[model samples]
Target: MEAVTKYSETELVLLLKQRQQSAFSYLYDNYSGALHAVILNIILDTELASDVLQDVFVKIWRQINSYDDTKGRLYTWMLNIARNASIDTIRSKNFQNNKQNRELTENVYESAGSTQLMTDKIGLRKLVHQLKEEHKVLIELSYFQGFTQDEISKMLNLPLGTVKTRLRTALIQLR
Candidate 1:
């Protein structure tokens, strides 16, 4: 932690570009939690957030030299990487299903423990809860569950275009 405070962000980035261990250690120690917060805010799943954080760091390691300091701050670069990686993870097939299973297990556990206490607590959940049943179902299966549009269509017994349209609408609503 002391070492992290030793260098400015630009200096740390320069060391990282040179593949310095101390720099990497300092970046991870100082910035990983902040990066993780951004990733988890978008992903909203612990396991997916963990995977995205790993991938984000790996990307930063690989692309260190490609970074142009003129474009933005080092923190911005890292934040962008984390966001892109988490979005990619969300778009992946495995993540969709895994996300769904995780959600279901959590919901079941929550309901079992205290149903009334968990009713649409967060802003996102509250907004999602306000959606029509079909839109809500599609959003759940596609985004949170990590199902593809085709998979969601098949699961819901709806046309492919319908699923796509609903998903688009749901995402627009979320935004």
Candidate 2:
């Protein structure tokens, strides 16, 4: 039987930052399952979830330098990456278009009542569409697409304070 290796979080972080393959392997062996579970909850498709899991590990390996122990645990940082990756996958243009195509096909075969139910499930998205254009864009990017405020600011070429203020106003209107 192969023996397992244990590492303190600090030791693991140090080794990972140093680009040690053994440390990465150990990290993956210990945390992949939990990280996969987190991705699965967001993605729901097993195959896609597995792909996202692999991407998450690669991201963790590459982004280890950005992980701040003073801010949070290593696992928590990794969890956030897994979650964001899953959400980003689902929000991709290809994914959205594919989902729409699938829904259209399903709706054609589904009963009228079921079609209405599916439409109702999009209530929040529909409401966001009703918001003013600026607020709507901010809400969709930050909430529906899981982008951070700073990311949205850079993408929209807007100031960070403007993004936050608009997001706050949008939430208030949503209430």
On TM-score, the candidate that comes out on top is: 2
For candidate 2, write residues 1-175 as lDDT tens digits.
1338788999999999999999999998889988876665445468998999999999999999999999999998998898789877866734556567445333322322333343333445446656887897777566545768998788778999999999999989988
- In candidate 2, which residue ranges exceed 4 Å CA deviation? 1-3, 93-95, 98-175
| lDDT of candidate 1 over 33-149, digit per residue (tens) | 988876764466689788889889889999999899999998888887886676577556444565775564344334323422343554444566678777876665554444578
Task: Please report, in order, the local distance difference test score of every candidate based on alpha carbons.
Answer: 0.71, 0.75
Name model 1 segments beyond 4 Å from true. Answer: 94-175
TM-score for each prediction? 0.55, 0.56
Candidate 1, position 40, lDDT: 64
Error of 1 at 161 (Å): 25
RMSD vs true structure, all candidates: 7.2, 9.0
Give Cα distance to truth, residue 46, candidate 1, Å.
Answer: 1.1
